[model samples]
Every structure is written in C-alpha cells, then in structure tokens.
Target: MQILSRPYGALHYRLDGPEGTPVVLMANSLGTDLRLWDAVLPLLPRGLRYLRYDKQGHGLSDLGQADRIADHAADAEALIEAVATGPVVMVGLSIGGLIAQHLAAGRPDLVRALVLSNTAARLGTPDSWQARIDAVEQRGMASIADAVMERWFAAPFRATPALALWRNMLARTPAAGYVAACRALAEADHRQATAALRLPAMVIAGDADGASPADLVRATADLIPGATFHLIPGAGHLPCVETPAAHAALMTPFLERHAR
Candidate 1:
C-alpha cells in the first residue's frame, strides 16, 4: 500500500527487507505490476532491500500522459533518489528490461548492476506494435489475452491452473494504461545507448519465449561488453513468474557479489 507522490500522480511501490542494505529494484513488464516479481522475492538472498512498483498505467499506480521510455525511467530515478542511499541492482523483465536499460544509460549512478530477462533493446517493429495497439484499442485487453498467454508461458505452464490467474491479470489491466505502454514500446529503441553501458550486467532469455525470442535476447547481450548471458530452458517470456526458483538461482550470486 506504499505510495510515492509525483508530478504525474501517485505511484504504488513496496519496499521490503532491511533498510540500509543493498537494494534490488524490480520493474515489471507492460501488462503487469509489482507482483510480477512476487514469486522470486522470497527465493532471493536475504539482508537486501527489495523495491518493486506498478508503473504508470499499470497496477495501482497512476497512468500519467507519458508515452516514452524516458518518462518511465524518470519516475524510477525519482524512486531511487527518494529511497536508496546509493546505487541498486536492477532486475527487469520484458518491458521492465527496457526500462532498466534506459535507467542504466541515463542514470548510471543510480544502477549498480543489471539483470535483463526476456527483453530486447528494440522489441517489435513500429508496424507490428501498431497492429497490437489497434487490436487492443478496438477490442480491449481481453481480445489479446490468449495470444499474450502463449507468448508469456510455455505449453506445460499454460496447462496449470495458475495460468488462469495471470491471464486474468492481463485481461483486467486498464486499457488506457496498456495502450500507453504499447505506444511507448512502439517507439523505444535502446540499442545505441545500451551498447555504450560499461557497468556489470547480466542478460537472460527463456528458450520458449515467443515475444522476445532467445536470438533477440542474445543479441541484446552481445551489445554489452562483458555481460553474462543465460538461457532458461522450458520457460517463456515471464520466467520470473513461470520459473522463480531458476530465476532466483541466477540472481542470488549476482546480488551477493554486488551487495553494499
């Protein structure tokens, strides 16, 4: 229930674990909120601050008029300055990953390391994203829920009852919020700036991810100088949700290495 007041509106955020410890800032994908990293939190190493928030237009947060990645990154920069004493380890998924890249490039001082999962510098092309925007604009969020589920989860996970919960989360998202995010994604291209980042970074991909395929994820990894790349087998776009244990396993050691 924590909320941070900003020019756009109130942003919903949750801060857990001890104060003064290293912070892990997690950003969710387009249609999700802070809960996107819920399953992975308890599995992570102890004695660290975990900060997650619902981006503008998602979760319980305000959906301002912002339609660019930089605007979203600016909100995050405000969060870091308000709560953190120093830089943080940013772990982002899907569009969250794009947000991380933008932050690390624009506010490198606020980010100590990065874990980019199931995302790319440039996601879908403008035309492809426009088509998606048109679909949702015309039929609403539910219209694309099934297609999104396929890209989000592998067949095995889709068969589980848990799948329905996430599907509903997608369908229930605010259309305006979702559309704003789609507009942002349609115009974002971070490759040029991300390739210039020099800090520690890790890139992860789900072998079964249809949205950001392995090859695309690998190409993003190739852009950064010395980034460690990993592939999670049998997982899809949202691996932190589908395979939290595996996701945390990769993140634990990295957190320990960079802990303040």
Candidate 2:
C-alpha cells in the first residue's frame, strides 16, 4: 500500500519478507493489479523479499494518456533501481512478462533471473488490439469482459464462484487504462530484444491459454538460448490463479536455483 511518486505518475507497490533477503519482483497482467499475485505469494520461498506493483494505469496506480510498451519497462527499471537496489529474480505474467523481457534486456545489472509466464514475444496484431481498444472506448470495459474472461480463465474455473471476482475486475478496469494497455500490446514487438537476452530465463505456459497459446509461449522461450519452457496442464492464461500451487511448484525451484 505504498505509493512511489515519479515524474509520469505515482506507482502503487508493496514489499514483503525480510529487508536483507533476496528480492523477487512480480508484475501483473494487463487489466489487473498487483493483487493478481496474491494466490502465489504465500507459496513463495520464505526469507526472500518480494515486490509487487500496479502498472501505471492498472490497480491503484496513477493513470496517464501515455501509451508505449517501453514506458512500462522504463518504469520497472526505475523501480528496481530505486527500491530493490539489487539484482532481482524478476517474475512477470502476460504483459508483465513483456515488460520483464524489456527490463532484463536493457538493464541486465538489475535482474539476476527471469520467469516469464503466459506471455508471448509479441502479443496480438495491431489490427486486433486496435479493434479491442475501439470497442472499450466506445462501449466501455463491459463490451469486452466476456471475451477476455473466456481467454483468461479455463471453462471449469469459469463455472465456479471465483469467476465472478475476475469478471468484476475486468469489467471495472478503467477504459483509458485498458485501451492504453491494448495499444501498448499492439505496438510491441520484442522478438529481437528478448532473443538477445543472455540470462537465467524460464518461460511458463498454460496448456489452455487462448491469449498466448502454448506454442506461442514456447517460441518465446526458443528465442533465448538455454531457456527452459514448462506447460501447466489444463490451465489458461492466469495459471497462477487457476492453479497457484502448480505455478509455485514450477517457480519456487527456478527462483531458488537462480536467486543464489
């Protein structure tokens, strides 16, 4: 519940675990906040510090008219250098993963290792993302909530009560925030940059993720030499939510081995 003020806007962030422990920074997906990692927090290794933040327009963070995928990366760079102040095991989901790639590529000194979950090197086509942006602008977030939820959660999870909370999160997202993020995704192409990154990297894919399908995530992993790719069966885009324990199982070991 801390706000880090910057020239662009204020970033909402929270820190946990001990002061001197290894740091793990977790970034959230588009249209969601730092709360996206709530399920996975307790499962993380003990005695390690954690940092989670709301991207400019999402969660409790300030919103602006700016739109650029790299802006998110820049923000992350500043945050890591200012607050964490040490090499960190950076973990990100969806668009957060894209930001992680950008940060690690540009500021390798700040990142010790990376965990990219359910994200692609490049997301969707400009036309497709623009269409989504237009829809959100004209009809609001509700216009795209159902379709987004379909891709976000697996069918069985959608049938449960937990789906309601996610639906509300999507529907309640600011139109400007959602559209700006869509524009960022549309314009972003990280294949060249991410492929050049030489670090301890791991990519996790959800077997049923419609947004960034398994093959697409796998290709992202292929871009980085020696990067490992794992698939969480039956999970969708938000595997950390649909199967937090399973996601932790994959992540804890990677962080433990690399955090040293």
lDDT of 2 at 115: 98
Local accuracy by lDDT, each model = 0.92, 0.90
How high is each candidate's TM-score? 0.99, 0.98
Cα lDDT tens digits for candidate 1, 1-260? 99999897899999999988988899999899888888989999999999999999998998898689888898889999998889999988888899999999999899999999999999999998899899999999999999999999999999999999999999999999998888999999999999999988999999999999999999999999999999999989998899999999988999899856
**Strongest candidate by TM-score:** 1
- Cα lDDT tens digits for candidate 2, 1-260: 78888786798999998887788989889889888989989998887888999988888888765488788888788788778858999998999999999889988999999999999889989999989988888888988889999999889998999998998988887778878888889999999999999999999999989899999999999999999999999899998899999999999989889875
Off by over 4 Å in 1: none
* Cα RMSDs, all models: 0.7, 0.9
Judge candidate 1 against the unseen true structure and give its global Cα lDDT, from 0 to 1. 0.92
